[model samples]
Target: MTRRPNPFNQQAMEEVLRDLGCPESLIPSTISNYRLFVPLLFTELGEERVYQLVSRTRDELTLGEQEEAWRSSIKYIVAWAETVMEQYKHKRSNAPKSDSPDDKQPRLL
Candidate 1:
């Protein structure tokens, strides 16, 4: 299968980030940095979640001028984070309780 160029190539991201005042030293050397970086947060919010966040931000920027695009992107990220937090909280609350014998209190002789 033919490989398509990554839409958010490293150089492009570096340029944009530099323009926005991110220190040149802090910019990642490649897009793969981001892909691998997300896993360090937690397993539940892994690479897939990071990809979804980037994709949503890209889609959100198509709505209008530069200022509006940035404004909308910020709003989108805030909403997305809230939704993810809620889903995680719900999932944790619904998880089955552990029933291991090791967790039971020991009887006094």
Candidate 2:
């Protein structure tokens, strides 16, 4: 793997979100809380799941650090987002399956 940067670059994160088709409304907060939940999301699910989970971006530190307030705020959002992602995964994985047996289904020519 390439050597990674600090994992918290402003412009790079914005560009990445743009590539992912994230909407403008979510661009700020989601990115701020991004690092908090990214690794956990990846490990529990996968890259695609990670993308789906982090649909927004935010800079929790919009004001000064002022203490640990911003960091904790980010953590809270990430935790909530993680629950949503997990629920979505469960729904997807348990979705209705095809009726035909695997090998018995006819393929298109």
Candidate 3:
């Protein structure tokens, strides 16, 4: 079977962080956390669930009078997660599909 493309990769993560104005010193650790956290969270809860959680948390943060830096960080994180999720969905939807009727039959090995 051919391998599906991975949406969350190091270069992409780094670019997102940089685009969000993440400090150069923090990029490595932030990427590390994202690499460890994103896949495990998605695998355990699925993409939609995780996105809902993040979106809800971000909304809550917006309602309160929180510190600027903290709120901004959460906003950027949510934006990054949203971008990754969109890419994942797009890639999955475009993946090759088997049209043959026999492809759906169980193999008698």
What is the lDDT of every predicted structure here? 0.57, 0.60, 0.65
True-structure RMSD for candidate 3: 15.0
TM-score for each prediction? 0.33, 0.34, 0.34
What are the RMSD figures for all models against the true structure?
Answer: 14.6, 13.3, 15.0
Off by over 4 Å in 1: 1-65, 101-109
Candidate 1 residue lDDT tens string, 13-69: 777778888766556533445644433343455445644555677656543235455
Arrange candidates by lDDT, descending: 3, 2, 1
CA error at residue 47 for candidate 1, angstroms: 22
Total residue pair clashes for candidate 3: 0
- Residue 70's lDDT within candidate 3 is 49
Q: lDDT of candidate 2 vs native? A: 0.60
